[model samples]
Target: MTAKFASLSCAAIIVAATHAFHPSALPSSSRRPATTTTTTTRLPMSFMADSSDYKADKSDFGDGADEDPDAAPAPLRGEVDMADVPVTEEIPVPMSRNNVGNRFLAVVLDGSFNKDDAKDAWEMHGDRIALTERHVMWARKQNLYNETFNLESRADVLWSHQLLSSDLQRAVGHAMCIDSPTIEDCREAISRDPIVRSLLGVDPETGMCDVSPVPLYRWRQIRDHTLRIDDGRDGLPNMVMAFDRPEAISDGLREEVSNDHLEYLIRSERVIAAGPLHVATPDKTDPRSIAIGTLLFFNAVDREDAIEFVENDPAARAGLYETMTVHRFNSLDVTGKFVSENLYFPGQNTYQMKEAMEHWGYPVDDLQTKWLNW
Candidate 1:
């Protein structure tokens, strides 16, 4: 329900907690000039939550967007007043693979802002959450009719109705979803054929090569609610579906199918944002293995809807993936409205950043070969 007041509900103006930035880590103002980083402070890119009511006039803080980065503090208004917000932090990239404690299952994002280009992420909590709620409902219904597909298949068509936040909608690109039941049948076929196993890398024991579950550094509200990452330039991408190619299928066939497959997805309106994984340089291998791909869906009203979409990808049809998973793209914690772009790393050029996203399986997956040209 929309927050309403007799005129404007107090609920509409609910206060968020203030986030503390290590002075050294505060994002540099975009309007200023700075070529090198000169500080090292540790503060989670997210903010702290506060519920105390605010009584300040709008003129006091200027809605937090235009707050002076150098201002000592505004003259106290009355009771409680919100503080200033700085640029968004760098992406919270998880720590590298290791074996420290529960490190195997834990993910830690690189949370620092020492670059001039780096800024905070935008906040549209009210809008994004509405998208999530509608999705949960869509998933429940599709899961009922989707028993026939592989557990990991993204059932996109289940709920034809889609709800998306404006930011989320803009970031979606071509996507292919796949997971299928024939995989079991393929398992039987491979067991009887050695050529198939080696070509497809099918384990005789398990037919699917297995989509390794890539644990991620997920973020949420300082109060523990999840958030979607929107580079602020592009829309906020809130969902991701990850799938890997099994050795069962040849790379040659998979690539051939993807040309048609991606086109089909876009025409079908199945994907909002989607793309395939590629190497820094084109792979010369005949049948290349697709490390992974991500899809920010448009019609994923439910889990089964998401599964249906994945199950239908042409690559999946060609036996490309071993496993797959779909879930919220939890990228950062939030308290108040963020004023700057928070989804990037400082000092990293867009070219380098695009390549680095492959580390998280998000290389501007459009499959355009020319974009990689130096």
Candidate 2:
């Protein structure tokens, strides 16, 4: 069953439909910088909408509406095959949940960790993985787990946040978003996890790990859009980017820039997930509650390709974001169709969790028993 589930998960395809954003009603600004690259040029019609909507915009096809016979075909409209699928009012598209409330992106870095040096740390590492999975299971029960993933290239651990260390020789960590009412509650959650505390490397006697939660007020993902998780982009590395907005940028300018940004992302078709990062639940009527930045998870040919993609965005060019960092990341399909269809079992008290841990080669005796108790 484990092997079969693994095989199926690897072959899963995720598809997301493009969202249409009509021109913003707010005032506009030409803050978007000019680009020399043809790929970055704005198209005649916004890619954020379906290609069928722009059939009249013949400019998209060269000067061959009725004159030239050699012009190439118009762009293919993105569509999903739902022939055999049942139709219902609530079709249960995965990852469409509007998980709201106070959430923090937590990062856990292990400085002494090296994937190659796993001999001595293997037992401890397994314990950590087992414990973290247990934590995720608990979070799932409490409706707190949003997403959990580790750095694909570096650490074996997982959590989400960015921390800079100058003297660090090597570091591996994971990141995740946890729903907690307050920062103190977030810290307590981290503290209760023994493995996380050890990973923080705080001195046992007097030292303490102080977690300053990076509050994510709101997260917006296109509901109907599905992405093929197994799209043949094996050569490309997945990327995780966090764009930080400078306070100086006003809501009007950011909204104007988003029009171009969204179009570029849709046209690129590399986006796995892309959305605005709000500091708090935003009121449509309140300009002050507007999103502060953007979070993009996508695929790129390489590091350079990822950098270029973000750099070419209208928001980046307009200096809307104060800092935008892109890093190569490996994504786990947690909270997505991959999890629900493969590893997860509805209700509880199943051996699903045990099977998952065993498949990952983690010692599951205690962890599995603990999970069953919940």
Candidate 3:
């Protein structure tokens, strides 16, 4: 049931915790500035919980070891008025992935935004979440009747339906993937997504949205130990996804050195998912589709570590890519679910693709010529 507010003035305003700098946010001629970064700090505020209710326990402060007699006595905890306190109402945390199906998933987006529009795109959270929840319900129903194909090949599944927050000017740093039954079904659902249509500008002539499906291939589980520790805070991005678009004429160099880059990632043992992002094709079997770029999701000590990891790759060293954009990523899953073990992609490991290929009846030789050659 939808909750109806008495009036728009009484409705709670939504706040974002992070921003993103998407490469697509800039025009081709105007290049994005490069800079190293750590995770942004999460302000202590939320609409879901009231910190104003916090009670002070003098015992918890350990009796001020070096008390300053000259300092004025601190104000009583309960003395301050609530209206006098400043607070930033940030969005509440989304559901955790632990309780949901551990199987890998995908999300496809159909929309367009210009470079100048990035500033205004980040607004609107209440309406976006409402629309997003409705889309998730519709996707779950579609999965029930979907009989053709499911990437997970499971009897029951929960699809992820969440919007990404950007810390930079870009509203959407990267596209997500949905585990729909078929490519066509996924595209149809995205077209009807109210949030996507409303947030993105449409082409005047074509009157259509630009569609792109990012199929995330999880190579291993998230290694929290390998990630850089922040100020012991919650709500920080635990992983990073770097999207690299190869130069128009560097296909030969990319293909020649792709294997080396894969080998480097496998050796590091921190790769969570890595694969190509392509233009939406008619179907998976279509032979006419061409490659547009590649995506790398991995664990790193910090943003700098991630940048160096991708920059040192054979493809990057060889100048095969025209641009690479790295953004902190957090996968939003179903809420109320918690698990101890963090298994990103179950029953598969990039380190042992040889055995996985043989187990699935795929030609092992193609692992070198085709799989790693992306």
Candidate 4:
């Protein structure tokens, strides 16, 4: 949060971040980061675990997160009533497998605590609103697509490695460990994050009793495991915007428009990552083509520019894409760096006698290693 943050050693950052958000483990009970609310009073979403009937559940996509989304939604798992919830378990709580049993509770407690109109869907859909705003701000601060870069030709290397380096990736990982509410060591990891503690509805210096804030703990579990993605300016794609091609679109039209647009986005260097989804199954004759909309990942500042580029695309104008969807994307493997290795697939699917994946644009040019500190 300050110049000191950047100077902090990895271990030091973790310690500070942890101590800042998790005040419950502090030496004295009064030092917790919470308001002096009656601990016994039932808070929002604290309902009877059982005998709490609800309308018949609607079907949802099952293959969530790591798997296919078209699959039927996994059956609801675990009890969500504040009373039945357990925060510190030896086995550790999971994200997808973990579900808030009470639909009402799920609706009321989705990682956000608005002082006014508590039941409003403000934080639902994965804190979509807050994250979106943060993303735009991150991009702006990073100075993406600034005047100097915009004036320069697309061919030149305009992006700076200052924020996109491997060291930053490790820094983000450390930040994530600190941010993660579900991480096994999070009790020690979070101490008093000023921003996060406020959101948890607790005093930044005086945390509430461990047992009383079940709602906060429950929501904390959810928030901790939500995702590890950062805003695009940090070189971590917080959102992935996908466009799908309609079945009726001809190859000629797709080639005439989308292909060139794809090149423009790739060369413009405004995006953290972009790719076209193709049949990854056993059926693809060619991995490059399957007629799907492109996926572009950018921070909030680039939102308008990204949308404009997509909306003005020849294919989009021609009504080739049947549907468009923008959803949050967190890279579990990439960490926070944009290393050359991840820029493209490692091996080729060359089925013609010999298939091999090759490098994209000659490995990142004398890449500087943080470990080496060259």
Worst 10 residues of 1 by lDDT: 19-28
lDDT per residue (tens digit) for residues 1-374 in model 2: 00000111111121111111111111112112322334465556555365555433456547554765677545434432345345535322223132334444444433233234443434544545555555444333333222332111111112232222111111123445655444455555555444465544565687665443212234444443743333325334343434444453445667777778778777777776667755443243346545656666676655445566777877777767654544444333333112322112223343675576456433344322232212
lDDT score for candidate 4 against the true structure: 0.30
Across residues 1-374, which tens digit of lDDT does each residue of candidate 1 receive?
11111221111121111211111111112112212435665433433357554444344335677777588764443323223334544434222121111100011111111123232222223323334433333333223221222223222211111222222322111111111122232223223222212222445686654211112111111111112222222222224333334342345655567676666565654344444432111221323322233333334434444445556766566655544433323322111111222222322335565564344232244332223212
Q: Which stretches of candidate 4 lie above 4 Å from their native place?
A: 1-240, 245-251, 286-289, 299-302, 327-374
What's the number of clashes in each of the models? Answer: 60, 17, 12, 32
Q: Lowest lDDT 10-mer window, candidate 2?
A: 1-10
**CA shift at 10, candidate 3, in angstroms?**
30
lDDT of 2: 0.43
**Candidate 2 similarity to native, TM-score:** 0.45
TM for every model, in the order presented, reads 0.26, 0.45, 0.45, 0.27
Question: Whole-model lDDT, candidate 3?
Answer: 0.41
RMSD of each: 25.3, 17.4, 20.0, 30.0
Model 3: residues >4 Å from true position, as ranges?
1-22, 25-132, 135-174, 180-182, 200-251, 334-374
Q: Give stretches of model 2 more than 4 Å off.
A: 1-104, 107-171, 179-196, 199-209, 213-218, 222-237, 240-247, 280-289, 332-374
User: What lDDT score belongs to each candidate, Candidate 1 first?
Assistant: 0.30, 0.43, 0.41, 0.30
